[model samples]
Target: MKMSKVFRLLFIGMVALSVLLAGCSKSNQATSGDKKPNELVVGQDANPTTMDPHDTQDTLAYGIQKTMYEGLLGFDKDMQVIPVLAEAMPELAKDAKSLTFKLKKGIKFQDGTDFNADAVKANIDRLKDPANKLKRASLYAAIDHVEIVDPYTVKIVLNKPFAPIVQAFAHPAGLMISPKAIKEYGKDLNRHPVGTGPFQFVEWKDGQYVVVKKFDGYWDKANAAKVEKITFKPVPETASRIAMLKTGEAQFIYPLPPEQTESVKGDSNVVVDKAQSTIIRYVVFNVNQKPFDDKRVRQALNYAVDKDALNKVVYRGFASAPESAIAPKVWGFQKQQMYAYDVEKAKKLLAEAGLPNGFEITLWTPNDTIRAKIAEFVQQQWQIIGVKATIQQMEFVTLTNQLSLKPEESKLQAAVSGWSPSTGEADWGIRPLLSKNMFPTAGFNSGFYVNDQLDKYVVTGLESGDEKERLNAYAEAQKVIVEDAPWVFLTVPDNLVGKRKNLSGVYVLPDATQDVVHAEFK
Candidate 1:
């Protein structure tokens, strides 16, 4: 899974070239009085691992996939859920098992195909397809059947009254696809996508760039992206991303670190915005390991690490100390009143576990400044407890692979990772990472830290859309995770974006949306 630096560098260079093309494009003919281009050019670090919306599990993938696909529901300016493809929120039947959705008419796929109830069926059936190979298949497994009541109406019958179904539609796995496109292209439809969205797929040069063009036939063209062509360039380094932003080589950076926030504060031409991000960073314990297998050892690790110090040194005060896996921005988040940085307590717990002298363990992270610095801080903290720590770094996807190994097949002892909340809820952040049933038998829950009590609360939170009930369930789950300490809860990131003076609409919501979607020059 590793590649030579030469190829990686070349790939980066090509991405730089793509950015230059987007910055210099004359196609679609959008220009200002100063003759600036109308096309919105964006930059990222790498190509999305998978373009198939349902197969991806990262913010980058969700951000890109959202551009070309519309879900049954979508988040608005305030991140409030509203109907898009759906004319109205589904109405629950008296039986409570059947949900009926009224579809919006006059919507057409990018390929001039009509969109109706049949299209909805096609979209849902694909993700529900047993052979689809989509990672999110489990989300829809309980769906009994979908009946098309009319051209503009569809009814979904579930095995149970799943109230969170509306929010689930906002997930990438629930993005609506063109039935004709899928039927014609089969599995390759991900590469060659067709949807009823603001943008249409144009070209994707592997590991370099992904380009999309505006669709003239979009239903709501008024708020349709102001720009013409949108090109996303993969630029991995923060300094490089910030440097290029200053040069006007790139208009918007996905995330300019907190370290650079103050640097850009004085620059009138550049603006920096910060808000609590739904993404939470943390270090996970491999429960299969003997020391970590003991709840006392896990809790001790939590007490040993200084999250505040780690936040200051690594995140430059751009993060909030997370008491649990879910961020403070989420509704009904139980604030862990205080994080215990008790060296004596940690030592005592280790002694109780028959390891007074401490033990050696591997702490793994992806190769990045924030990750590496955080690992160094944890390494120092572990040292105080008389434990020798070995720090290792790998690619983000590689780390995902190691932690995703099956129970008996896992090689990782512990790793640093976190979730980017795609659905803007704790249900997404906690369930998929900790719940045994959410991930495949050999997938992300490779830590195999099963707690039926925790699973019950997470499921309860997800099954009911009733705000009070869901929030209470989430609060209970957070308390359990804090006491259990399967992972060292770190901090909630502040979404930081640096944009040139000319760029407009550079916004960040604490959810899955991560792209510079509507960026434009004044």
Candidate 2:
């Protein structure tokens, strides 16, 4: 009540103190400092089928191995094709059918093996070996062989002038490993991996984890991984993985549960790193099957499911709604094409396909949580259209092997399968997945949807190096898949990555390759 100047100043000071206390209570920074982890650990969904880079198609293998190896060509941060191991990008012969690579001198493999033309030849020979059973055999099937021009240079002879040559070498499937290391370790490379990579294998506990230490001899060792050691422990269960992160038992994680992504949105210790990915989830329908053979049936399936509903109720809005078979992040997406959800339209289509009420279909899905959830959500949506889908769950390995069978032998009707990009290769979305030429064997085209136009465009896309021509060809290919509806394009993804604050350079590719070098735990 006393209006003295000193009292007024005291009252103002008291008000300031109150505000400061309230601010301190809410301030995250006041409690503690954010400390970076000392090592970078990763969680992989699966183990590598082969440690030999040339003989494996498993993406997890590539992700872990890339930190330890280099390709003749590489994609920069901008996805521009450039030289990595080579002195410069390979020059195509006048005919453009032959690729000549000039190697960098004084380069050494992790095993201290000489890196030369002979080393390149040995690696090429191993990739060509049929006994290896590599998943990417088709990518190299056309290669005539490697010809060493000299110790520092070599030439690759293709049967024809195959374009996308720069793209081919940059794919994780195409990275080079030391020939000496392969000969010494053979397939036991997992336990004793030797590469030009920045890290060296320390131990691997199958289904548990893998550990690696920094290889000080790496070409970019000074700027390479900062961690002294890394451990990759597996907690396959979604809840368990998240629980590990909460307890600080795990420093990094992947594919954070759809519902749990929000938990790390702005935390001081943890972070959610989101990026566009080449992964697309969809329900793959076998075109060779009876009901699916009818385009109307495929359209019905696409129309019945509300992708918005799936993203909301199932994915909790953590995923984006897919519009086309090719992801929007990938070049050549056909924007005008998408199968809109129309319950009545789906019903009419089903009726047109001679099923007025509904049809029974078997839906196969992996035992994993996300995939199972997607299948269940799709199953619910199908019920609205009178289509009853019975869920059959199996492990990924068994499920994938089972899916790759003759339609007659498949014993299941429609199944949920996802497509992923290969260094942003449109062929990853087209040929090997939809062409009759790749039916049930070469790749995911287990559905055997043979559109002559898709096949021609796929070939054309793969045959041309011109960006305009290739993109135009892929655009046409996307149109074919959308119109054909061989599969219900569900959602393209933003990769869900949760990491400790200290890890830098955690390179996650638009494709599936994950790199740790250039990453340091500060």
Candidate 3:
């Protein structure tokens, strides 16, 4: 699908206007050169909505929380599961129904609490408690209970055979919090964190910065922090973040804006780091709403837009069109045929659906540059097919609230968002977003997408450990989802970062989380 001349001109004009606005905007003059050598300041795109790991759904918060918390299992840069607090890899039962882990002894939380089987059981119990209402409960719903075998050993008994257990523990939601703190702070634990990781939480000045200091008694000395203190500062403006990096105001920054990648590459003071990411972007349709409820209307929307153009224009070629519902970097990802761009086909589908004149919709998007651009481009494409789209851009928090509305109460027609399988597996990639059991307030199924066949296929994949069986199940699942057209699949963006030349051991993981524990200045 080639981009129309008018679309290309609109994109160029938008880019020029953004550049002009950036030039006219005032810049902050703060510099980090005078700071102590042992302190590392990092800039992120936005402030995390919450500091509590279990309560957070945002990626930036998880990255910062990881520095303070340690999970039984962890993921390396390649997204492979490895042991962090556990003595070694867990022992799985033959039926894939249970997993046993040997806890590492002589470990203590930052608050001087003992780390043992009891602590593990306590955390799991809290998550499983229906009264707590944690958003991640669905991921662990298969767990029947946690059995304490000994002071240093624990067993997780599952209600059924679940294949993604290990990957689930490696997720940020899987990161363990201090049981003692859970008791002491209770609901206030979101502001107070105690963990056994290399860094201990210092303070979180909401909407400004989160501070952490080194833990002198960390268990893993080899992976311990090199710096005494690390500060995560939220700098929302892309140009301001880049300027800070060049001026030494920030030593590192996650998500170097895609449009600025080439410009940053030529800078001698900054080095560009890239990782294959599991983050997939798409526009989700509210299937419970009018026009979108019809499969033909959904499929027509997918056919109207050119995904290749979206990647090139919005991502500056830093992304690729998705071949599967999940990114190829994730485990169990299977390739499937995607929709080809066809304006005429979209028109025909709309006519067949008894709406030859098309319909009007309120398209919601966060006020981020990339998402806004994608929304604008899509709006133009849909206009060609007689669809009138009114874009409503809001703050990230506001957008989240709107998306989180109950299906019956929601007025949203469509929304532009992205999902990263923080666990780096297909189960985490597809289940929460597409499954019938994951509707809002439960999981992230905000679009209210449901298909009986898809739900069964997802369960079938989880019920076995056999590679071929899971592959076949996921392949069928992908085909069903594509045919349903619940979303206009966009791109799997590359994880790009910018850091000072002297910074060492800081990089974005394939799951879009940061491994900043071993970071230091050269």
lDDT against the true structure, per candidate, is: 0.76, 0.75, 0.86
lDDT of 3 by residue, 192-249 (tens): 9888889999888976899999999898888778999999988767888888788777
Evaluated with lDDT, which candidate comes out highest? 3
Off by over 4 Å in 3: 1-36
- Scanning candidate 2 in windows of ten residues, the lowest lDDT window is 28-37
Using TM-score as the measure, the top candidate is: 3
Please write out the lDDT profile of model 2 over residues 123-152, one tens digit for every residue: 777777877655565666667899989998
| Per-residue error (Å), model 2, residue 363 | 2.0
Clashes (backbone N, CA, C under 3 Å), per candidate, total 1, 2, 0
Query: Sorted by TM-score, highest first, which candidate order results?
Result: 3, 1, 2
Please write out the lDDT profile of model 1 over residues 161-257, one tens digit for every residue: 6656666776667888788888898878768878787888898887578898887888876768777887887776667777766656667777676
| Candidate 1 local Cα displacement, residue 158, angstroms | 1.4
Which is superior by lDDT, 2 or 3?
3
User: Over the full model, what C-alpha lDDT does candidate 1 score relative to the true structure?
Assistant: 0.76
* Model 2 spans > 4 angstroms off: 1-37, 46-49, 181-193, 404-412
Candidate 1: residue 480 Cα off by (Å): 1.3
Superior candidate under lDDT, 1 versus 2: 1
Candidate 3: 10-residue stretch with minimal lDDT:
26-35
